[model samples]
Target: MSGWSDSGWGLRMQSWGEKYNQSNLGSPDCVSSSDTISRPTLWAEPSPVVPKGADVTLRCQGQRGRNRFQLWKDGELQEERNTSWHLAEFVLREVDDWRDARSYRCRSGQGPLWSELSDPLALVVMTGDFPKPSIAVSPSPSVLAWTTVTIQCQISSQQSSPDYNFALLEAKSLQVLQLQSLSRSQPYFSLPFVRAEDTGSYGCIYYRKTPPYKGSHPSHTVKLTVSGPLPKPTLWAQPGLVVAQGTNITLWCSRPSLASSEEVTYTLLKTGTWQPLRNQNATDLWTDFSLPSVRPEDTGSYRCTYKDRTASGAQSETSEALELMVTGSLPKPSLSALPGQVVEPGKHVTLQCRQPLQPELWRATFILLKVGSLQPLQSQRPVGTSAVFPLLSVRAQDAGNYTCVYKKTFFHQVSEPSDVLEIWVTDASPKPSLSAWPVSEIASGTNVTLLCQGPPWTTRFVLHKEGSMDIIQDEAKFFLTRVTSKHSGRYSCSYQLGTNGSLWTQHSDPLQLTVKVSSNTLLITLSCVIFLLLCFLLLVCFCHQYIPRAADFRGNSFRRFFCCSCLSQDVCLSHHLEDPKEETLYTEVAKERPKESSVPIDKDVTYAHLNIKNLNERQTNPKETSTEATLYATLSLD
Candidate 1:
């Protein structure tokens, strides 16, 4: 074993690394004390409490030949040492420092195989010289469950720069809930979704960062009381009664439906205070919880609650308490239909729930519940011998298993759930067909008739349209006297087998109705005309870039006449017949006409600069005919 020299040991040392002999080192497992061996104990010498800048010694003692020891403070390992002596000494000088007030322990062993951890011992470093701080709870002390609370720890200090570490402690347990290093005169701790256990006495303490880390005295205690129990949640079970030894039963809980899309968790409970059996998350008002297969031991009261995980924290409110009784002998209550067990699809049907109980339970509440449904079909305390639930125009979907139960309203004492009575309806009739008049595009303001043909036995009909929720009527024909764009949709019709029943035949294939431009005929025509006019304007603009215009032709009439006179060997003239002063003149030039010509254009002419620039530019560059207009009229023999 190796030991370190004394000069190398420093009291300010935080942690020391160690090495061990591989042969003596055991596997990385717990050393069994089953083998006869001595365990080591650790203690701090010269008192556990010391002022800043003082010295302290930590000693580890145990049986001889152990060769190694490890020390931990507050569950964190301080150091490991490999030594020949069974006893090890750790010199910690300048005692008031990091983690000096925490509890510490040590264990000794040869290698990875280690001894049981020793009991924790507290070491207090006297650091009560800093100023005491004040504690404040925001918005009063009492808070509802799942609400946020801010606890502010402030010290009265004019110092612009704070140099202290803040800590909030539970007065009774002395447990530190918040420990932070802040340079603020007032620092707050935010507690969200605070539970019942958070209600207690709390105090704030602070300390400046110096040699021994001097901490202030604890502030005056503040009492916090969480007002309500976790809000109770609505709890119920599916296919209920929670039969013992039964398989696949679901427990459900309901909460006020929120628009928030956050999925929240639901916890199932056996009792008000019992731990949850399972947790499930969903966004709907109902959260279904599944439990393990029921057993004799599983028979108990069950409840549930929803936890809003999207909130500040996963805060929850428990549901109303509900009890479930498990027994092999369930009551056999009589269930029957009113008109008859076997009825057609179009007749009214009624289910009767009858349960036998004590004479005093006549006034108790009775419920008729259809199986697989969480809500009862009917619940009433006024029923005498039985409760009758009228299901108007019973459809195929209204048929299922049903049972009844009597519960004492005052005490909520429930009787055994009755056996399920299965009832079914026959609704297999010939489906009807739909026929829309013309079966093609219909002009606006025209009356159209959609005739739904069904078997002669059918008595009712329903018209449907694609992408719409409105049901047209209960007739074989749907008449649209005034068609419009709104009527342009896929239409179908279904006819009922009987007038009083709800079961109807499958809808016929859709007949698309295309209603042409309805009330906006004039507006449509105007829009088309405007569209054509714009197109014509665009075409004119496109051609105008390359073609000469009438205005330019009229302005150059005189020049054209002069050229015609020079080439035709005759003088020609023209005039606007409507205007007496408007005329075109050409000089007589039948013989030897001048080969060059120029016009004394007025300065008011729009293209004067164009003419002069073209003449000069063409003379300087003859091959470039871009200014070829100058060749048409040469400067007067220049």
Candidate 2:
């Protein structure tokens, strides 16, 4: 065995061994044999230190024998193969503070068997500062009450044999809340029931669990804010009240949560139906819904909801339902009249209509029509229930039928027409005129009819005859059955008016009706004349004796004699005319000659004296003649 070195020690050992053998052994054989036998030598190379993470190789060479080489690191053997010339290499995979600087050696089995350990291989790995841990919240900034949220911390670089510790801090107060060790590069922390007071900025710090426990920079901060619950809402109505049908109604929705500058949309609900009101962007406390025309079907309970433009969520609450009741429609009406269906012209008539129960909301109108025609005679609206139509002087045109109708305020409903009424009018009749059919030839017992004609409008004709009290009334014409002496009279006719309480017209011009006598009638009249004459003769005879003498009382006896002679000449006339005259004359004579007178004498003497007196007066008036004297003598006869 020999020590390993790079110097020439084996040649010096041969020179000295030859000189010592010549002196000590004193034999030529001893010197020659020692010089012929050889000695072993050893050598090592590249013995300086190497840097960490650098590749290193060791080699061992030996002389004059088969040798084995071995390599060692920090007193521990590394695996290698046997050979006289040996070589080994290694790469440094990791280095720490203590293991970064260490020595390595190589040894041989023969020729002194070992080499001194090599210089230290100092490894200085390039180290830099760790990156800051990144922090983040799970649900961003929105964390509700009693809800869990996650916080995460992550390091940029990882180590092979890494150990990690984590610390959490509030950014506002710098107060630590949690500290723990973890083996992973990224760690997570859970926070629950975050309150308003718990709301703040937060950050995390991470470090490796080594000798120095070097910490990484803090993460970026994040902020969070918590809010409370919203307030309740209210709703109401506009115009504040409801009334009868056809009235306009309005409803309003309001809320206290409405901000002055915020817009709000309102929804009006009725019986599960929803409607949007006007002014959806209004900030006022209420919104309105106008119902221009309301009816019974429109009535219902109502509520509302509101949404603010700036609110995170909609605020809503149900209101007390308001009940609306609307009045119903009016009823149909009825029309009537006084003296109902029958009316007379030239008289007063009244029409009436009865409205429904609500009379204030309705009115009536009357229409008068011709019986069979659609043309209206009159149309009128009366303030009261009854209206009167007066016909002062009625004519045929005034007669007609009439009816009435009633209507509601809105004109949407009307009543059936009233029962029809009829009117009748009348005109005055004319006087009738009469005429004889045959002018000059009417005989007794002849059949004749006195045709009495009146006005065409006359309903009844009345006939009258002069000097008679009987009246014959007929239609238009009058007839006399037989013409007789009794029927010979003036005939006339008149007409009767065909109206209530009407009077008859005046009588017409009279017509004369003459009857001629027959031959038998003429004979009977002559007989009557002869018989009356005979009766007169007998009366004259009886009155003659009673009469006194006329000559004794007469101063103008001749004039008297002539009148008596004229009367005596016609005995028949004397019979009818002389009796009353003779009586009157005798009365005068008897008065002239009283019974006590002395002048009394014989009849002849009285007569002579009268004759002498008459002669004397005749002589004085020569107009007297002898015929006159004879008339005197005849007058003296009783």
C-alpha lDDT score of every prediction, in listed order? 0.59, 0.48
Return the top candidate by lDDT. Answer: 1
Model 1, stretches more than 4 Å misplaced? 1-245, 248-319, 325-351, 355-365, 370-372, 375-384, 389-493, 497-506, 509-638
lDDT of 1 by residue, 218-277 (tens): 788997665443344577776765353565677778765331235677777775345667
Write the residue-wise lDDT of candidate 2 on 190-246 in tens digits.
665543333456777654433233445467887654343323345554443333567
TM-score for each candidate, following the candidate numbering: 0.27, 0.19
**C-alpha RMSD by candidate, in order:** 27.5, 61.6
Q: Compared to the true structure, candidate 2 yields what TM-score?
A: 0.19
Q: Which ten residues in a row have the lowest lDDT in candidate 2?
A: 1-10
- Candidate 2 regions with alpha-carbon error over 4 angstroms: 1-345, 348-428, 438-441, 455-459, 475-477, 499-502, 527-638
Cα lDDT for residue 593, candidate 1: 60
Task: Give the top-scoring candidate (TM-score).
Answer: 1
Global local distance difference test of model 1: 0.59
